[model samples]
Target: MKIKLNQLDILLEVAAQGSIGKAAKALHLTQPAISKTIQEMEAEIGMPILQRSSRGVTLNEYGQVLLRHARDIDRSLHQARDEIDNLLGKAMRQLRVGFTSAASYGPFTNTLIQFQARYPGVKLIVMEGRPQQIHDALENQRLDIAVITTANHTSQNSMYYESLYALSNTVIAGNQHPVTHTTSLKNLMDYPWLDWDEPGEHSILGQVFRRYNLPLPQNIIHCSSPWIMARMMEQTHAVSMWTSVRLRFPGYSPNLRPLVLREVLPASSIGILCPNIARLSTAGNTFMEMLRINTRDWLQDSDALEMVVRV
Candidate 1:
């Protein structure tokens, strides 16, 4: 009933380090002291939290349940500290954001400029990753927000999802590539295909091939980094699919051109994903406000895709 914050910290450290001895060393306490803290925590909860093993200690079912709450508490405490720092005019306020490569195209960059202008005191940390990796970071409290593509407007319990722009997926190739002149998806199969490292038939190109009952491209090079993909597209005659929004960015490679295709590919929307339970800091809320304002026109133009199916 009277469990302390230090007790939860010990539990987390032990679980992270996987043994009492390691946790004790990491926390600058003796093994007995770490064991005593864990024992006190278990006594308060009236159950064994960790399972002992010959190799190492692991979290039992009870410990696993408590670990989730412990992490939540730790996140809440950090948020509280950040809020206080912002309120007291401290310069240590920081916001961590994760984004996919496509999400960094136009609107995201514009919002970052505006956010930095408004909140110069706050430090901004940005990371680019796959959609699933970004989502996992958001769930683990490692990131304050995420910008990524959402296939549909489905609801999630742990995170808030908002679709800002429904972008058309366009087939792109080097300007001198022979496939750029072809309008049919079947014709594209002749050349090497450049695509993301997504598994199975989940990619937009895969879906397009499946829609037309065409066999997937045999000569495929899968790369996860968009920058590297762009480089590969420019140097080689490989065809790839990318969002139209990415093409609008001023920094995009000039060697790449969107192919005018006869087949309509599915549309994916870019959006913001943030934790539902953790209230954003003042700086975080301000950045979101700036993002929402900057993307107002994009939301209205979401229906402006020329050769894409609205999904």
Candidate 2:
């Protein structure tokens, strides 16, 4: 059963506007022409697509099925035009990437710089959010790539993820804090602590205390952004649980120091997540390659880990 693209477009417009006359006006077609086209569609499909009333029309179950395919066709046609324009060098390639707050401390910024240098014509958009927000954006196709913690969410069939590296939660304190000189966990808890107010029982802070069979710190300061926490630690005696990679970054040093705890906190996997590789755009794939290569180089660098310890 062959159907015209315009017919599908008309059907979608009608569904959107909830009125045949309104859809006709929107599409610059006459009301009778819109009505006849929909009739022809229903006849060809051998089912009534919409339930009509005096006020307007709404999609029936059959209409909903057709609307789904129509939307897919619209998306594909737009992508086809974009891909063709990119190939002809007439349009800039664009990639939308999403990440959690932890990404600010990771190698993402450095890799993005290399990607920009290599693909100067490509446009990059980066978004920072909580893990749940990033997951929602990925599922909605608003993001082409995501870097998130493994503890965030489990990958489903549509979401593909690969572990880039493991990250250990480190306790950070001001350089002048008394706990900075101590390796004892008991002494570390004597000061006020700051961390995200994450409700999960498996959060790094909760897990660290559970592993030691100790109660959680009562003087915990709940804050979300790691940058704020780092800045606060620089000025105050407040300690926070953060990724050790923060030390490797440029700004966290000279003031912030990771406490040398006797027990190691469990390491969490930091993964590169995207829609199945096949769904990635050219720019997305290129960025992914650069990210993987940079991350590998950073991990293999002996000096990087040493810098973490010195911090």
Candidate 3:
């Protein structure tokens, strides 16, 4: 059988948990699938790895043998990989990261600029895509890391990732919108509110409106891109809600000033998104750490990120 290491990891978890249900829950797999794998392994080895009964399941004697050896195999393999990575040296390793279009041009670039200065050998491959695309690439193992907008309810429900850093608490309006002083969402609710996120209404704006017990305003302007939104704001009284990080972009001009929301809009977090799996290689790990540390410091000092733009 072409059993892979990931499958083996499942095997180990199932054995330790002593229950297929718990193992599946822990690994985010279906119960039957986990059971089938264990059974298939037993059949391939010509030994009962699990003793099943009404009470639950227990690993059999031969299963113990396999477990011990499997653990050693995993340890040795990991050590070998670490040694090889070390031998390759810093410059040889690669870092493939994906980011939202804005982040690809924004913080993602800043993080890399700093990473490059320290680890010049590391090659960076960057992609700009939608949030869904970013999630897909990471889940498919096509990307080592990504900067995604967690506003997608589907993504939040899937728990496909964990956070690295974020920018919370923001208010946004187009750069040239006539109404400039927007402290509370209530101020702009009656105006031409841009309906950028249409169908789901599950965006950060949705949560904010819902929390205040205010129905979403029907008057809408549906357009994507903060740049486009900014332009729309420039011509009309229309305004679009967005997080502060969107303004942090070098492209965001003094003209597009996002007034802080007074009713306390939900904080929007922008950060590095790692897949549910283990972290990347040593170089990737180092880069991720740099992101967390740097992002925290970046938000603290937006001036530093601006400096990256100048460089």
Candidate 4:
């Protein structure tokens, strides 16, 4: 029998669980294989590593010493990989950026475009999802950065948000809808209304519903798609509630006007969010800068209210 570092790792897991059966299950190995490996390890080390009982196994002094060193080695190995990856530019070779569907309509899109233009050598992968979904992906190491709103999760990792632009919540209705001509909410109450009835756990737009409880007309369009919802806004006299960003999309709000609803609809801020990983690749940091600059222009540009910024 020969002592080996790999066998030592298996020994550590077995010691922590106090049973070969449990360690086998955790490591996807057979209990006999673990037992044989540990037996061989004991033979090489010339020391008893465990004491068995009907209930389970317990590590003796030799096992404790081995386990401590195993853990330290495991941690050092991972830290070394992360450090070497940074030194060799693993971060810049590829990237996956995530954004909410709403952001795809503007800022996020622009940032990716600029990032592509500037770092053509780097591969870019983009994913469109809800804020919470994106946040979860980032936390799990599935995404590099996710542009999300406050209702979404925040991370303890190095995270930063540049609130580059804000969208004004406004009243919306189809072009021919009778209420489109009405100047105030009082006059608009006469028609069937379409509302952005949020489903599931998404409550980002609940504020708009609170101020205006007009019975949502029977013919309402509750959706998760900004593109489909915008088109629906133009068809039926269904009065839709949306942030000012929707108006600027090609098919939305071009001819629509903000409803003078009874109460003011609060605006939502959109930003570029970055996780402070020990290192952000040169391309990633540069993309972030481009996003900020692009959004600043869109936020200040009213002539073309809805602006799409592609990253």
For lDDT, the strongest prediction is: 1
Residues 1-311, candidate 2, lDDT per residue (tens digit)? Answer: 78898798789889999999998766656799999989999999999998988988999998999999999998897699567757854344777889876664547788888888887777778898866678789888788788886543345543667767766677888887866454866676778888665645536677678779988877887777777887888888898877756676667777888878788666656778886554466677777888888877877777446433221
lDDT of 4 by residue, 1-311 (tens): 45676686678778778889998765556799899988887888899888899999988898888778878877786688567757866557677788765566665687787778877888888887766577678777777776655433323343555555555567776666664343755465555555434433455444444447644234444565767765665666656666665666675557566666656555655666665422455556667767767766766655436532222
Candidate 3 displacement at residue 285 in angstroms:
2.5
lDDT ranking of the models: 1, 2, 3, 4
Backbone clash pairs for candidate 1 read none
Candidates 2 and 4, the one with greater TM-score: 2
| Alpha-carbon RMSD of each model | 11.8, 13.1, 6.8, 12.3
TM-score of 1: 0.63
lDDT tens readout by residue for model 1, 1-311: 78788788788889999989998765556798898888888888999988889989999999999999999999899888676766754423688888887777666888988787877777899998877778778888888888887555432543667667677788888778866454888878888888775646346666678889998888988787667777777888888888876666565658788899888777777888887523566666777778888777545554334422344
Identify the runs in model 1 with alpha carbons over 4 angstroms from their true place.
Answer: 1-92, 153-158, 180-182, 250-253, 297-311
TM-score of each: 0.63, 0.62, 0.64, 0.58
| Model 1 RMSD in angstroms | 11.8
- Give the range of the ten consecutive residues with the poorest summed lDDT in model 4: 149-158
lDDT, residue 214, candidate 4: 46
lDDT of each: 0.76, 0.75, 0.66, 0.64
